[model samples]
Target: MLSAGFIVAVVFSWIYDITPGGIIRTEPLPKQKLPLINKKVKTYRFTTFVSVIIIIGLLSFNIIDSASARKIEKIDKTIAVLPFTDILPIKYESIVFDYIGNQITAGLSKIDDFNVLPWRSTKNFRKGNKDYVKMGDEMDATILVDWKAIEIEGEKRLTIEMIVAEDEKILWSNDYSIKNSWTEISVISTEISRNIARRLRTFLSLEERARINEIPGSPTALYNAYRGRSIAQNALYLYEMGNRKTDLSDFDVAIDLYTQAIQVDSSFAEAYANRAVTRLWGIYTTHYSGNELEKCLEDIEKAKSIDSNLIEADIAMGFYYYYGKRGFDNALKYFQQALEKDPANVDCLFYLSLVHRRKGNWDEVAELSSQALENDPASALFYINIGTSYDYLHDFEKAIECHNLAIAILPEWPA
Candidate 1:
């Protein structure tokens, strides 16, 4: 329509002249001026009109495209939980920062509509430059959660905000007092997650609400269990980073912490499940001296008896089949079940990818590894696995690209 209107206007102007007296037919130019008139028409009139219309069209398109992008970004539910900034004294930083951040992330991961990136994905933004907009863009997250800790007398308080990643608009903000107990952390984190979900306009299933709200074991036992978990995860990260001695020492300490939690609360299913996995890792790393497999199975059974739907227990069972018995089929089944419960879980996704690789399902391996990387972008193992899958599928270019990404992330480890 616009082009047609422009053409009509051009033809009308060519055929008639508008003047103060009246509209009149355009008279033929004198012979002396004919060349100049022709030159003006040929050199500028046609080309200039078309160029102006084209520029207007292009500008309109860009404006529409940018508006559409902003609209989509506004509704995108992808979230990245940034590390909690601690303003307390040096001795109180890591424990408060890591535990609260991790618990909040776990709580948010239970929401079905939220693509909650794992804590590792946002670890790089903990210190130094704290630009939420840039961080969200780099992580491909539309929502960014920020947290800050302040000490008030003997206790600590946390201020949190869920922001629109594009513009740092606060979608939701709240503050909670932190007590010296795991139950308090659990309750506070769950509340914050629920608020964020509500702001995003997503309803939680009964099962998800129950899972996020579950406060298990005595306060002391829960504290020990979480501390053990933190240690075990750090040790595992170190092991992956080429620290060979991590399994021998740090795993032992983590296992002992879990043991303490179990002693305090005999029915702490999560602690049992965590211990089972840590024990299995010890066996996998060839650092175990006793019957770690038997112990792992016993813990799995104990955890199931305590809470049949415990995801940690299910994940432990999956790893048991994978690491202890090499039963890829069973591992796949258990991991799939866990994945269905917590679709964005990095551990479940990684374990499923590993099982698929063993079962010669290269496509499934690549797909699951890619999903794992979405949650854990900093994990070189996921990139390496993806590269391996591509190599098996004979896509050498993609394989090399993935390998290079892994190498870039961890130059110390040979991709």
Candidate 2:
């Protein structure tokens, strides 16, 4: 209506005169002045058209954005937990500082209704002055969970907040004084997970509640497992960064930590499973010479005997077939099982992509790689996998595009 009225006013001003005398049709200007008047009118019209176009473009963008936001709201159950910020003195910033957030994230991932983004996808936001809502949108997460640890008057304190991604509103928040023992921290993580779930109005099943409440066999074992897992996670990141030849040291350290955990608690299935994974990758990176495949299989069997539904065990078994035996068929089966339990698991998606690549199923390879990339967008390895699939499929244009993206993300990587 505003646009139409503006146009009508412009036309009326050109065609009529509103003077103190009366409303009247304007007579044509003198020939001497007519050119100048016409030029002014033409400029005004061009400006008006441009203004209208700008208005339309702005309106169109808003409409599209609103629609996208609505679509995002429909998936509000999708959540991303960012890494915890440590503001304590440098002396206290150890593996314990990282474990709180990581434990809560693991607990929440057990819930069926909450589609939690993998930690790999959200960890990079730890040090940035990031807008939580924008990060959520980038990761296709409709909610964000963040926490920070700070020391106040010699007392360690932590504050946790859940934010709605659409408006960056704090939907829920709580604070706690940090605990001294690893067991207490584990309990605190479970409490935080439960509190967040309640804030979201979701019902946690009996099994999920058990998972959140289950502390490992002992504080010593749990601490060792936590440290091992942390080291392994970093080692995996370094491996992904194309440091294939020199990254074995971290893996070895991680393996030793896992072994310590296993010694502390013989029934620690997770530690055994993680040790198997580190050993498998260590050998795979060294062209299957660092550790015996049978030792890796023994860990897998030990973990599975203790807990048949262990996802890590399944993953280790999948790699056992892929990297150890080159048994693509068995690799596919184990990976599929793991993916069924955790659809957004980046490792399962990545391994499945590799298996399909070996089977010459380019379409499946691309599909799995794309899913993995969604969970770990900054991962150059996933981009390379997608590029390889495109290359094999004869899509040279897209193949080059994917490789360029990988190179752009990792410019220091060797050609």
lDDT of each: 0.78, 0.77
lDDT comparing candidate 2 with the true structure: 0.77
Per-residue lDDT of candidate 1, residues 30-63 (tens digit): 8887664567677786788789778668867777
Model 2, 1-415: lDDT tens per residue? Answer: 4545655776788899998999899997778886654888989989988986787667667777667656544546888887766554666545676666666677788778888776645664544676876687676788888887776566767788888877898878999786565335666777888988877767788999998888765667877788877777666656766776654688778888899888889999988888888777777777347457889999999999999998988998998888888889999999999999978788788888889988988789878866876676555666777777878888888778778877765666442
Cα lDDT of model 1 overall? Answer: 0.78
Clashes of each: 0, 0
> Residue 302 in model 1: shift from native, Å?
0.4
Clash number for candidate 1: 0
**Model 1, runs deviating above 4 Å:** 1-74, 85-88, 181-183, 201-208, 217-220, 240-247, 359-363, 374-378, 392-394, 404-414
Clashing pairs in 1: none
